[model samples]
Target: MLPPTQTEAFDELPLVERARSGDDSAFTDLVTRYERKIFRLAKHITQNEEDAEDVLQETFLKAYSHLGEFQGNSKFYTWIVRIAVNESLMKLRKRKTDRTVSLDESIDTGEETVVREIAVWEDSPEDRYSQEELRGILEKAIDSLRPAFRTVFVLRDVEELSTEETAVALDLSVPAVKSRLLRARLQLREKLTRFFRRKGDDVFAYL
Candidate 1:
């Protein structure tokens, strides 16, 4: 069934109640409302199309089974995001691989204040590459981030969730979310700067 557009308002509380009462259609409606966004978040975390799809299915299934336990402390969306994040992390653990970039790593800057050095784009790469190509480049850079930083980056920057929302979803404090996001951005900038430099394009300058 087609989901209503964002502009089309519906009372989610009623739908939630209906679904809790075994109204299958109501549950389907709720799925329609959130599936696309949840899939995107899963994809960002899993970094594989197939794994993302699996995560999407697993997330909804778990949510359905645990619906009775939900206490309404946070938005339903935030609750489901927490599930997706956990499922994604489980997948990572099963793979027995480590993918992380350190936040404490510092780069030399002329200023007294310590900070990570990131390359500044001279002319936004938007001017040099097609949108599709730039998107591919950006995706690669994001994928290279350590999972901790990547999750925070995806939630706070790409998904545009608020710091509070991100913190709730990841079960972290707001300050932790902010710290991870800052490190994620710095790592991405450094990566893209190196990429453009390696391509011999004067697109970015290292600061």
Candidate 2:
């Protein structure tokens, strides 16, 4: 949600202020800034396009209605992320009514980890695979993760949220966020490990 430059990031406060003051254009601008990223995050969580679209629409609707309650303690982006994530989680909960385990409360260590160490890739993923292929492999793997782990991975790793920002967005303790993030990375690593084995000193360099 944050812009690359600090100046652009600072601009958000003014936009937020203007939007809070009932400036419709300012609100629209804010939506334009983050709608795609929010949709991706929702899709990552729910793994359903329809649910993701619903979450995206509802997120902005709720944000618009609750602008008065925004305390401005957090960045506008982070606040919106919280709403979006909560909505995505709610969607999953509705679909999983038979399950009794809490999404946030679960200990997600049951997945087996790869015992063999995989070599690091010398080149970026883009150097080896087309963007479409990379995205397909990753999205499919990430979609297999549990909702809680997927949320942590998408916010912390994919969206590059700071640990503190993630904690605030998900309303989790810092320690809990760290633990879940570790589990998420481990899960993703295990999934990706199946794709490229350590044939030599590097990952998939021979190919």
Candidate 3:
């Protein structure tokens, strides 16, 4: 994975060094800091709690084993995230359930790529939806994405990883990450546009 900004690198240097030097507590501390985020990322990709848990455990196991190869060039978090992402994808591969779009393949964004004006959902919709209901609707939209697109979206947008970080995590080029992210956003916008209108949400926004 790509190294984080200098500030993030500096912040993590001590713990990484300690962990690399066989400090068990330091390794534990690293896990403590990032386990939840990794689990969430795994779950988002696997779409199964059991698979996510397995991925989470395996991610750390691999990380601990490979600590010596870490090279102190990247943020420990970024490295672990790459491991977690790879493990999650491996789980999907084993299941043989998901059809992944190829990052190297060029697919048209439709005949005409006109930007659509999407209506944004407000705090309270006219239909009086509960928060859980709203969240479920969004989740459904996200779940509709292909595995490749979904991974890019989760890493770059949900996890708030930089484009560079996401590119490295997925072993993709920066332009590939950007292209896939755009496709993912456009797909989500299209999927969610109808929901907002159906719920009588107000205010238009670009997605």
Candidate 4:
């Protein structure tokens, strides 16, 4: 099934009706509409391009199988996001369950990429060279966040979802979402501070 056009109207009703009737093309249209956003959410949560792609494919497949159960109580996009978030969390939990890493060690590993990327974003870029450098740095920094914290921050901050919306998407309580977001921000702040301190020292020495 080909994906539908990027129409701004609420096409969910029609799509849902079609999908409910087992129209494969309608389902395909739905996938086309959301594939990019789903992939991005997966990438941000997983910090791995390969894992993100896998999650995207798995999410849509699962969503397809469960189409009959969809209640249409919410927007289709929101419903899709709920599924994607659950899929990412499931993958993350599975990974953690398979390993036993110390929290301190994990924090150290996460800080390197997060801090480096934060530093890159601050550099004033007057040329293409500088812009490209900044992009690479930011990507690395985003990839450095711990899987759990990274997902929370990306959903709440990067995606600009409301607290309620994030909670719904993650199947988390409002308080849980708030606490996770706070921790993510604190972690990012610490990483960014260290980066700036190093830059400040370099500038002072240069002066």
User: Which of the numbered candidates is closest to the native, going by highest TM-score?
Assistant: 2
134-153 per-residue lDDT for model 4 (tens digits): 56655566667766567667
Estimate, for each residue in 1-207, the C-alpha lDDT of model 1 and write its tens digit.
Answer: 453433454568888888878888988888999899889888888887888898899999998999888777666777888899888877766665544323233322323223454344556555577888888888888888867788899988876667998888777778777777877877777777655543444444344
lDDT of 3 by residue, 73-111 (tens): 877888999999999988877777545534444544643
Instruction: Tell me which residue pairs clash in candidate 3.
Output: none
lDDT of each: 0.75, 0.81, 0.81, 0.69
Go through the candidates in order and give the C-alpha RMSD of each one to the true structure.
6.2, 3.7, 5.5, 7.1
Tell me which of candidates 3 and 4 scores higher on TM-score: 3
Clashes of each: 0, 0, 0, 2
lDDT of 2 by residue, 2-36 (tens): 45544344458899999999999999999999899
- Rank the candidate models, highest TM-score first: 2, 3, 1, 4
Off by over 4 Å in 1: 1-11, 97-128, 192-207
Between prediction 1 and prediction 3, which has the larger lDDT?
3
Q: Where does candidate 1 clash, by residue pair?
A: none
